[model samples]
Target: MLEKIKNNFNTQTWVLIPIAIAINIAIGQLVLVLKLPVFLDSIGTVLVAVLCGPWAGALTGALSNTIWGIAIDPSAFPWWPVAAMIGYMAGRMAQWGFFKSWWKVVVTGFVVAITAAIVSTPIAVYLFGGITASGSSFITAYLLQTGQGIWSAVVSTSFLTEPVDKITTAMLAFAIVQGLPRRTIGGYPKPEQVEVEGGEGEGGANNTQMYIAIGVVVLLVLFAAFMLRNILGG
Candidate 1:
């Protein structure tokens, strides 16, 4: 794991981060205005999770959400990390093949969506309500405009959104990995020893590098979309 961590920060990975940040910001803002059901923000988190597992996912998630939280309200400090954690968990689950099948994806979606709603709604209510004692006004306006109780609206949104976000994220991550160079993914599957023996090791580092580079690139794309939305537009 430590070795993997060391490798994850290779020159290529470092280059990708800032570029990804810029792209995510742009995309995130555009999507918000377009009111797309799919969110590009969580893709970086998902890629991190897929490539480096949950820890990487957590970092990606937190950063992405923090940027977004600042846009929503400066007082939403507490909620950012929480939301990021949720993003991390979703990515981790997807990595575990939670979305391997359509049925599985549907089931995973239901579970994640509900959990996001339960965890996220109250925080939103609190934050939107002026962060004061009488949060009643904030809650009232939210509910009135939606024509549903705040809880219902939030919960429904969560249920509907989580699946769309997770599935798309998972699919994108998979596609990026497939498209990347081979060494980038796993060091070439032992190409050196494969001298007619098998393509087991050595020589294929280049392929692995490509896979890694591609994965890193995908992560950046996600980050750029998110950053654009939170900073430039917001």
Candidate 2:
């Protein structure tokens, strides 16, 4: 099974990789059409993670949204990789069969959100957090203020939004992957290519080009989101 997967990676990555990346970016833009509170594009990141595993997911997630951050929230630019990688890890965990049930998926979603928050909170606080009286406001305004440092503000803000983003994204990814027709990643597999004699390796997980494709996708989506958000005042 591993051998087959590796072969798939060796062969079609160059071609399918770019296409997948494009699809992911376009999907991210399309998610904007829904205007959900959570970022639905995380679904794409998760899907990549689940199918191709962590590396692709991480690469794709970090890249696409990192650019998005730079373009959209300039102050939050550093967080793009943080968000994408979190999504990548979450999706990878799910694909490892961590989210077999609906409730499990929800829990996984929350887990991802919290994980993202934990990973990103400190960086946000140290970098751009001192922006307004936001941190001090937490100390004075919010009742349960432990303190007001980079950690507090980052954790607080992330706690507010990361869970929502994670849950929504995980749920969405679960549904999409479940619904997708089980075939090769590229599409209906060629009749010439029979299912190898082993357990299901990631349908097209072997494709290395897939990563390149995902990377391209990440860049394009970030660019698009950056431009679109600016235009729409999002």
Candidate 3:
């Protein structure tokens, strides 16, 4: 296991981690500033997971959240495990060939989101009394007021918020990987993990897939908005 984990890191992977961490922190802070409902913070984490490996991805996620917490907000310090799992799961999905196409990438994103939700629940429940500083915690607070258990409220909030953000993050990461030069990508530890499934010749099909991914993200955003409306309107 250690050997497998070690193989995921090369000089390029090492170099990528810090950049990925910066991306995570910058986007996360931007979302916080904008009061966005979704946290698009894990794009870099998923990118590293797909391009490097699970271990490296996990490291990037952990460090990203840690640095963000230390330098920006103390509240973020406790969620490093959730961030790490996001990276780890994204990497595992890529290793399993899920990163090779737009639809599979969506699946990867959903899985990562679920992992994040599950991992974050305990932290939210125990560390912060089922309410953190995030906007999503409003959902948890409302659920608690309605007499839901703390775990249920936190988990429900996570379920409501995680999928859309994570799926979007994965798709964006995929787009970034597609946009990068082949030579630059080749320097990464697992460059082949991100090779488009149908090859570049299938441009039309790839375009269709991209559209589907975009449509899904739009739908998820609308769903989240609807949920927020219901929660607030209630």
TM-score of each: 0.54, 0.60, 0.93
Better of 2 and 3 by TM-score: 3
- Candidate lDDT scores, in order, read 0.50, 0.54, 0.89
State the TM-score for model 2: 0.60
At residue 190, give the lDDT of candidate 2: 24
Residue 153 of model 3, lDDT score: 83
The alpha-carbon RMSD values of the candidates against the true structure, listed in the order shown, are 11.5, 12.1, 1.8
What are the per-residue Cα lDDT tens digits for candidate 2 across 36-147?
Answer: 5445556666665655555555665676565566555444456566756665566456555655544556667767877787877556556655333333233222322434
Off by over 4 Å in 3: 32-35, 199-205, 229-234
Best by TM-score: 3
Tens digits of per-residue lDDT for model 3, 19-115: 9999888887788799876789988999999999999999999998899889988888899999999999999999999998888988999999999
